[model samples]
Target: MDSSDREVRDVNNILFGGFTELFCLFLFLVSAFFPNSLLAGDLVEQWTGKHTRIAWVQDQGNGLDTYGRSPDLMLYGYDSQDGRGARPLLTQKSNFFKPLITP
Candidate 1:
């Protein structure tokens, strides 16, 4: 084929690839924004194992250093039956504050 024909084919290929990528990205974003409508009882039960309550705690700063603040902590617990007692399953500490070291 001639040089001009090859150039046109290349341009068309690039445009088609870009459009496909953009369409996939748009679909993902739309799905993420929509509320979850499916029932997740089985999944929740399998993960949490029976009756469980997740607790999250936010440590309020003393108002001394407004820039550097600690993140909130998350805790998971499981309690079964009447007055069975609560058991802590997992605990995690997150860092939502500004990092001390520069990237």
Candidate 2:
């Protein structure tokens, strides 16, 4: 194409790219500024008598031998009369706790 046509194409490309970037930035800003609608309703409804489970693995230090650590899963439930209580449901000791890597 001619010089003018190339310049026009370049300008169009730059404009389109800038528009896309601005649109994405606007969407990000909107989401950041607005509280999450899904979680904004009620605090009591979110945690009242609800059960939460967490799965994790631990590590142990031993010499000349190794052991397989079991998967630890814990369930947490909140009760109004139970007061604030925290407990470690499961624990294991293994080297896998640090430098997590997949086999």
Candidate 3:
């Protein structure tokens, strides 16, 4: 209500904002310094296979079309990098070393 009260509120807001900015900077620094090498460890274990599938499908919208870009430009997804042909790899029970997983 009063100028003094307003000033105090402003000070509190500034302090809170500064703290938030500093916290964000600290988080950015931490993430930048520390690599997430272990984040894909589980997936890496699954990918440790005796065979790697090669994908072959339609144009991934990387080419030029009559309009401008290909209408088939692949939409982003969990398997965006993989083509339609990669379904077999995902559907298969053991994409890894079959001998070890099966026997």
Global local distance difference test of model 1: 0.39
Best by TM-score: 3
Show the lowest summed lDDT stretch of 10 residues, model 1: 78-87
Better of 1 and 2 by lDDT: 1
Report the poorest 10 consecutive residues by lDDT, candidate 2: 73-82
- Whichever of 1 and 3 has more TM-score, that candidate is 3
lDDT, candidates in the order shown: 0.39, 0.35, 0.35
Off by over 4 Å in 1: 1-15, 35-103
Please, what are the lDDT tens digits per residue for candidate 2 over residues 1-103?
Answer: 5797678668867867676456335433433443343232222225433432222232223332222233232322222222222223334333343232222
**Given candidate 1, what's the lDDT at residue 34?**
34
Q: Candidate 3's residue-wise lDDT over 1-103, tens digit each? A: 6797688668867867676456335433433443343322223234433222222222345454322234443221112222221133233222131111121
Tens-digit per-residue lDDT, 22-88, candidate 1: 6335433433443231223233334446643332233344534332345543332222222322223
In order of TM-score, best first, we have: 3, 2, 1
Name the lDDT value of residue 45 in candidate 3: 31
Against the hidden reference, what TM-scores do the models get?
A: 0.22, 0.22, 0.23
lDDT of 2: 0.35
